[model samples]
Structure formats: C-alpha cells, structure tokens
Target: MIRVLVADDQAAVRDGFAALVDAQQTMYVVGRAATGRESVDLARRTSPDVILMDIRMPKLDGIEATRIICTDPALQRTRVLVLTTFDLDEYVYAALRAGASGFLLKDTPRAELLHAVEVIAGGEALLAPSITRRLIAEFASRRDPQHPSPQLAELTDRERDILLLVARGLSNAEIAGRLVISPLTAKSHVRNILRKLDCHDRAGLVALAYENGLISPGDQP
Candidate 1:
C-alpha cells in the first residue's frame, strides 16, 4: 500500500485529505500533523512513502520541514507533496527546491489529490499545467539569456533537446511522441538528464531550463 502522512495546520484539511486518501484502495493515511515540526517528527518516525505537506504551518513551515526530511538519509525514500494556495507561487518554487517531489493546490479535486499522492509515492514529480507556464516565466525573467547557461555544456545534443521539451512541461509519453522514441526510452533519457544535472526532480530541471534560457515562455515541444 502507498502510505501517506498528511501535514496541515488546519484540522479540517487534515481530516478531509486523509478521508479522501483512505477512500482509495491502494493508499492509506499513516499519520497526521498540525504543525511542520510535528510533520517532520512523524515523517522520521513513520517513514511514510509520501507526506502531504502544507506550506504554512505552526512552529515550522512545510518548506523547512520538507528540507529537513529530504536531507535526512533515513527518509530518502520518502517524498513530500506540498499543499498550497494558488497564489503562492513563491512557496511552490521554494518547496520544490527544498526537495519536495511536487505541490498541489489546496482546492484540488479529490480524485486529483489521490492521484497526486500516488504519483509522488511512485517516485515521480507532478505540477499542474495551470501554474507551469507562470512558474517558467517567473524564473525566465531573471535569467540572463545573453550569457548562455554554463550547465548547457554538460548535456549532449540529444539530452539538451530533451531538456527543452521537459521545460515545455511535456510528459514522458508526450516527449516520446515528439521525439519519435519509445516511452521507456524517453523516460530513461529524462532520468539521465536529472542525474547528470543533479536536480532533485523534473521541477528543478524545468526551472533550470528556463533560468538558463533553454526554453522560453509559451514554447511548444
């Protein structure tokens, strides 16, 4: 079963999210916490497959908690899926950098919430397409397009091409279709890109691609 720990300062949110997850046959709630510190403690004690973390919490914020848990060697297998408000793009990027596997809006549909947990537990990062373009653009603005990215030299021509598509927010299957390669081949290439780039997940690579001017806002695959 996919074990999950819900961490939100609000009781109603914790209970609601836990219920939704429990309704799923393949996933279960292992614990719940109302504060980020408690979440960190429970995460270490429970070692759940996924932690549903809220960005704002008492004592410690979810971003710090995620960072702590992610840096812990014992919790390496654990993935953190941050819960946040739609306008909190700042927190979203910060959490991803803190080693969170992904983030979901607080008002996400129940089905999507369950699916997100499963995705994170299964060792994949996910982002809502609604926020992706804005996110890329936000970082893209800070990027010095004229200087060129130093990290670009680390990739082969094909790898660089793959990174560009990834920045466009295409899935592995999508990438495969675009590149005329098998899905597994596309996924493998993505994994290699992440490893070679030393990124925590696709989220980091996406930001890196835009921050390095590899992919521009509204670019198609």
Candidate 2:
C-alpha cells in the first residue's frame, strides 16, 4: 500500500482528504497534521510514501517543510504533493524548487486529487501543462541569459532536443508524435534525460531546462 500523510491547517480539509485517501484500496493515510512544523515532524516519524501538504501554514510554510523533508537522503522515495489555491504561481514554483514532487489546486476534482497522489507516489509527476509553460516562461525571462548550462554538455544533441520539448510542456506521447518516434523510444529518452540530469521528474526537467538556458521565453517547441 502507498502510505500517505495529509497536512493542512483546516480540520475540515484534513478530515476530508484523509477520508478520500484512506478509502483507496491502494493507499492509506498514515497520519495528519495541522501545521507545517507538525507535518515535517509527522513525516519523519511516519516516513510516508507521499505527503499531501498545504502551501500555507502557521509556524512554518509548506515550502520549507518540503525542503526539510527532501533534504534527508533517507526520504528520497518520499514525494510531496503541495496543495495550493493558485496554479503555476510563484508559491508552487518555490515548492517545486524545494523538491516537491507536484502541486494540485485546492479545488481540484476529487478524482484528480486521488490520481495526482498516485502519480507522484508511483514516481511520476502531475505537472499541469499550462502551468509548465507559464512557469518556464516566467523563469526564463527573469533569469540571467549568461547562466552557464554545464549540464547540457553531459547530454547529446537528441537529448537536448528532448529537453527543449519537455520545457515546452510536451508529454512523452506528444514528444514521440512530434519527433516521429515510437512512444517507447520517447519514453526511454525522457527516462534517460531524467537519469542524466539527475532529476526527480518532469518538473525537474522543466526547471533544469529553464535554469540552464536550454529554453527561453517565447520559444516554441
């Protein structure tokens, strides 16, 4: 079973999510917290496979909690799914930078919420396509153009192309179709890209692509 921890400042929210998550046959809620610090503490104690974290909380914030949780090399398999009110905003980006696996809007459909937790827990990510594009554009425009892309040197020309496509928020199937390659090949390329770049998921690919200048604002895949 996929062990999960639910964290939110609201009692109703926590109870609601716990009921939904725990009811799943493949997952269960191991604990719940009402503050960021409590979430961090419970995470270390519970060692859950996934954490459903609220972006804003008293005594600490979800971003810092995620950072602390991810910093421990032992919790490498522990993925964080941030719950937020905004989509692709700076708070979400900051959480991503802090090593969160993904983010879901507070009003996300119940089915989507369950699916997102499963996706992140299964080592995949749940990055919204529109959010991906916006975040990339925003980061690329603000970051220095002169930023060194040393990681690109570790990738081949084809990998570079794949990375650019990922930055453009293309899925593996889309990448395959665009490149006239098989889905398996496209998937393999993405997997290799992640391994080579030392990324956790597509979110990492997007962040890496933008930070390393592999992609720029207003650029099309």
Candidate 3:
C-alpha cells in the first residue's frame, strides 16, 4: 500500500482528504497534520510515500515544510503534492521550486486527487498545463542568460529529445505516441533524462530545458 500524509490548516479539509485517500484500497492515510511544522514532524515519523500539503499554513508555509521534508536525508523518498485553491497561485510555483512533486487545486475532483497522489508516489511529477505554462513564463521572465551549470552537458541525444518533450508538457503516454515508442520506454527515458540532468523532477527538467535554449518560448508541441 502507498502510505500518505495529509496536511492542512483546516480540519474539514484534512478530514475530507483523509476520507478520499483512505477509500482507495491501494493507499492508506498514515498520518495527518494541521500545520506546516506538524506536517514535517509527521512526515519524519511516518515516512509516508506521499504528502498532501496545503500551501498556506501557520507556523511555516507549505513551501518551507516541503523543502525541509524533501531535503531531509532520512525522508528523501517522501514526495509532496502541494494543494492550493487557485490555479495561478504564485505560492504553488514556490512550492514546486522547493522540490514539491506537484500542485493541485483543493477543489480538484476526488478521482484526480487520488491519481495525483498515486502518480507522485510512483515517482512521476504532475503539473497542470496552465500551471506549467505560468511557471515557465515566470521563470523565463526572471532568468538571467549568464547563469552557468555543468549538468547540461551530461544528457545524451535521445535524453535531450525526451527532455524537450517533457518541457513541452507532454505526458509519458503522449511522449510515447510522439516518439513512436512504448509508454514504458518513454517513462524510462524520462527517468534517465532526470538523472543525467541532475534534476529533482519534471519541473526542474522544464526549467533547465528553457534555460539551455533546447526549446524556445514560442515553440509549441
């Protein structure tokens, strides 16, 4: 079973998420927290496979909590799925930059919410197309052309292709269709690309792709 932790300042939200997650036979709610600090504490103790975190919390926002949880040596495998109420919330972008596996609106359908948890738990990143575009624009607008990173040269030709597609917001299945390969093969390529580029997740890959000029801003997939 995939262990999950739910964190939200509101009791009703936490309860609702817990019920939805617990109803899934493949998942179990191992813990719940109502504050950012408590979320980190529960995560450290339970070592859940995924965490549903609220972006705005008292005592420390979800972004900082996600950073701490993800950076912790003992809890490195715990993936955080940040929950927000708005699609254009800037805090969601900050959470992603802090190593959150994904972000979802609180009003997301139960099916999609469960799937988001499962996807992140399975080591896949999730970001809505609109959110991805917003993040890309935000980063692009603030990016400096001269920033240097040696991780760019580590990618092979095929991996570079996969990275470009991922940056274009293609799902694994979509990428498979585009590249004329099996979904499994596309997934493997994405994993290899992330490892080669030293990226934490697909979001990081997208940022790197744009920064390195692999895909132009005007390019559409």
Better of 2 and 3 by lDDT: 3
TM-score of each: 0.86, 0.82, 0.84
Off-target runs (Cα >4 Å) in candidate 3 are: 173-188, 211-213, 216-218
* Candidate 3 minimal-lDDT segment of 10 residues: 124-133
Q: Per-residue lDDT for 148 in model 3?
A: 44
Sort order, lDDT high to low: 3, 2, 1
Q: Rate the local accuracy (lDDT) of all candidates.
A: 0.81, 0.82, 0.83
Q: Residue 128 of candidate 3: its Cα lDDT?
A: 66
- Error of model 3, residue 109, in angstroms: 2.2
Pitting candidate 1 against candidate 3, the one with the higher lDDT is: 3
1-221 in candidate 2: lDDT tens per residue? 99999999999999999999988999999999999999989988889999999988999999899888887777878999889887757877878767787778889999988888888887743466566557655755677758565666788899889888887878788889999999889889988987787776677678777776777667775
Single out the weakest 10-residue window by summed lDDT for candidate 1: 124-133
- What stretches of model 1 exceed 4 Å from their correct place? 143-149
Off by over 4 Å in 2: 170-192, 195-198, 216-221
Superposing all C-alpha atoms, what RMSD in Å does each candidate have to the true structure?
2.4, 2.8, 2.6
lDDT of 3 by residue, 9-106 (tens): 99999999999889889999999999999999999999999999999999989999998987788997888888988876778877776778778889
Clashes of each: 0, 0, 0
